[model samples]
Target chain A: MLVGTASVEALAASAPTISAWREQAVELRGVTCLQVTAEMRRAAREAVLPPALHPTIPAAISIQAWRVRDGDLGAFDFVCCRVSCRSGVRARGFTTGACASTERASSGLAGIFGFPTRTATIDFRQGYDGADLRVEVKGKTILALGATSPEPMGPDDVQYTSTLNLAHTPNGLRLVQVEAHHLASKIDRLTAHLDSFDGEAFGDARLRPYHVVSASIASEDISLPGVRFVCRPDELAFTGTEPVSRA
Target chain B: MKFGIFFELSTPRPFSRENEWRVYHNALEQCRLADELGFDHVWAVEHHFLEEYSHSSSPEVFLSAVAAQTRRIRLGHGAVVCVPEMNHPIRVAERAAALDIISGGRLELGTARSSTWTELGGFGVNPDDTKITWEEFVRVLPQMWMSEEFEWRGKSFSMPARNVLPKPLQDPHPPLWVTVTSPGTELDAARRGLGCLGVSAAGYEEQERRTKEYHRVIQQCEPVGGVVNDQVHTMNFLYCHEDYRVARDIGVPMVTAFNVANAHLYWTREAFPTRAYQTLGNAGAAMKAKSRPADDPSAAKGLPEGVGVGDPEHLIATIKRWESIGVTGINFLLNAMEMVPQEQVLESLRLFAREVMPKFRDPGDRSRVYAPTTVPGFVSDPTC
Candidate 1:
């Protein structure tokens, strides 16, 4: 998992209060940072989505599999990948890392709900309040999880929060906003696939599936250079030191 | 002074709920108007996945629609990216021939290897291999067009040649044009004995130099296709109105948009590291925003100095400059980036036909303008 964080206050400042913030959130929903480390181990490796819908979806369904040995990482890995759809049309290649965010969000939602569930459209707006990160996911509410003891608390504490704000607009069920914080450890697992598959695939490759082995919410304040986020006095603060923010 | 109106089928502001359909119908109307006005050609570009800059990804379908409506105006592809990933050689030859037959021999094939990374990487084409693939496709196209049964085994593309159907009406084949943006490619086009379609945005001096080089190379050429070539055509931006300032005000934005969009789609992809070509979505806007005055007459800005905004008189002056530079045909870009209302474009065409075309269409002027040169030995048909 590749864990990264961006300042929510900064994002909010950059985005407009009404339309821009909501649009930015939706745009952020497409962010991906995960990488795959295993190839097709099962024959019934159906593409995650229907073929007709592949053109519009964030993740590509078709992929070529390859094997690689990562001496630096000290692991053997298998990967499935395809050229980005946008790049394929332009006849060029450049792998974008942010696509994994969508995959992680999809998988997390799928785990909480069930398979073959209709994807609820969600838009996330990110902003920074001082050093604290603020993220809002707006859309149709499907599944909402409340925080349990020992489980980390998200902003609204429906721990697995899925809120769909349909009543806000007359056109239809458009996402409005749901605020949250970036729990670094939880995000680390959400984004783990990004690192595991990097060295395993050559050239442009599709992201690998997420394998959530373990996840924990840090309760202590963590400090890193060039980063400042305020945690509740008793609550844990998760800090990311990487210069680049994948989400 | 032959006229060809350009259509990229762009959709500007107020993208209606049914914007796509409106744009398509609008383009067809423009083609019909151009045909009615006796424009010599109607050229449509082939661009994929570019939202507003270009919506006509399927030029074959669009051209066929135009072919059904227009009578005299030649139907042309500003380019069909000859790289195999975008289209196989056999497919290209077959489609071109079909369109030719459908258009009653009014088809002109303009071949190119696309410049943008968005197209190259999107189709999983290796940039290094595109040139080879294009060369192979171009070489095979003539065979597909001329032979009853064609078979070829090439390093990049291979096929057991079968009878390709709907042979073109133009004797051996249709007139061949290779679209070129650079001087090197112009020379290459000349060496292959193919007609040079100098599609660059360079000023008249640079175009003159490139056209001179093309003529020089054609003089000592070895044909790459099945037949030799005789003429070179250059594309220029032309919007004519009674009011020169109105032409500049309205037409300049569209022309500038098209040039910047084309360049951005082509150049910025090279800067990034990737396996598939993707558009630098912001690059076009950034380029347009950073635009500066073309004070330098000799800069390689890809546009002729006197282009963009002009009246018929101004257009005549520009054509005179191009004529002095030895361009055989002047392909005026009439409706660029879908700017200029259809009525306005038709008005511009009608005005040019009345004011500028008459002087160039005179027999005396034609004879003085088109220089006679000996046909190359390999020409299958010297009539063109």
Candidate 2:
């Protein structure tokens, strides 16, 4: 992790030792965000983590993008994002496999937490500050880090939240449904975003309803008028100073 | 096709007294510039308690100021709310007549039934009854303008036989128009022979369907004004630069801000639960919002595939699409939410005039600058 963390069990004798750990809080308008961390004090207790995975810090992060378009998934129209942070810290966009793979999910520690739940709720306000707005994604869903290659899920391959809704069919099939908010339009913009399995070890057993979410605000110059920049992820750092501004 | 400018007079947060004045005067300056740029007309909305969405509550006064500053560009109420509760029909007639006279008959009288709960409730206008009231108001308005001593006993207002003084300079009245936001309103505008002043930022497909419906229906309808002003004037955003990317970069945020602010005023049964706005904001406008990406942080924000917010070539192609759809004119919302600076707005207008206007503007012979003197070829002697 970017910043070191004390062991939970080591704090007191009453608690048992655990190698893997994760924590997050995502209420954007309330100025809160998800912070994930995984600590390993002893190799014996940290067996849950995938092999060859290590923690990374979110030292500097850049504003990647925030949008909610119509999608085929049942949880369509929720705000979601791919927040790229320094030192290889990628936020949520995990699939059922990543959430189950505690080792790989916690491998990239120290990132943001977000709620990509079934419910489509977004309360966003912009221009309260000179160039800043507030976003709130209340409610709950699962959080995890997904690695495109089993190479310890870096920041770029991870996602902050998921907004695609997965429906449990009568035949026990969890099929992706059209987005809830803009149902008529989302059907056209749907893509199979969950195909980034990367030969992981877990079956699709951890598929809770999938939901996507994103928080976007436009400012008039002083407030991030957000001129469109086709700058690649690397170029973002050159074009803009990676501000630690959360929420 | 013709072009014009429309305003909601939106300003940014931390709105001070200074910003309000600046918004008004900047609009006047823009109107003056629009006249200089040969834009056909300039229109402003009449709204109340709309916070930052629209501040132009008194269109007559605003148009008066605009008229005094500009010489050629026509001024319109883009429209005036015609509910009797908000404005007595007689008063609307008088005010419109006065403004028309002041502007030397260069007035387009656009009328509307209140569309937002904030305004309908503020004026205590009944949504279900507003349509009837507006129909009565609009029908009677023309009579009030044309009749020597008008007398009317209607559901909304009853006036004794008294002259509606200061009759409009136009033979019958300024060309009539109505805000066509709801689905059937365009047909209603056609049936009444009024121009469709569409508030919805409809897409090309929708506009084409509606325009076709209007043109076909209006041909078989009776006239509402002195003569049929069968036209379609739709709303759109305008931002032009040599570079298409540069134009969108500036236009997108402004367009998004305008849409968001507009949505706030649109009453949904869930948010407001009011009959006004038909328990929903303009259906077409809402669909327009739905058609657009809810949040597009990228610079490609403002106009879509066929919108008047890009390079001259892009705008020309976009306008041709609208023209092919049978749209007669486009009213460009030059600035909103203070997203684009005043200087940027001026530059955009100038660029559009230079690059886009000439393609569509007819180079026909000029009409008379002034009507002939009362006694043709008569010379007045200084000695007399």
Off by over 4 Å in 2: A1-247, B266-279, B283-303, B365-384
True contacts kept of each: 0.00, 0.00
Regions more than 4 Å wrong, model 1: A1-247, B13-17, B266-304, B363-384
**Can you write out model 2's per-residue Cα lDDT over B1-384, one digit (the tens) per residue?**
778999888766567999899999999999999998888879999988676778888878899999999888888876888888889888888898898898989888898887664576556665557788888877787777767767777788887787887888876678889888877789999897888998878876778889999999988876655557788999888999888788888887677667656644523221121233342455335345335444432225445655567888878887887898899889999988777888989999999988788898655511212121122222222111
Best by TM-score: 2
Alpha-carbon local distance difference test for all models = 0.48, 0.54
Q: For candidate 1, what is the DockQ-based docking class?
A: incorrect
Output candidate 1 Cα RMSD: 15.8
Ten contiguous residues with the weakest lDDT in model 1 chain B: B268-277
- Global CA lDDT computed for model 2: 0.54
- Which tens-of-lDDT digit does each residue in B72-142 have in candidate 1? 77887768888878887778888999898888888878888765544554576665476677677677787
Model 2 agreement with the true structure over A1-247: per-residue lDDT tens digits:
1111222222122111122112222111212122221211222111211111111111111111122221111111222221111211111111112221122212221111112122223332222221221222243232222211111211221222211111121212111111111111110111111211111122122112121111112211111111111111112112321322222
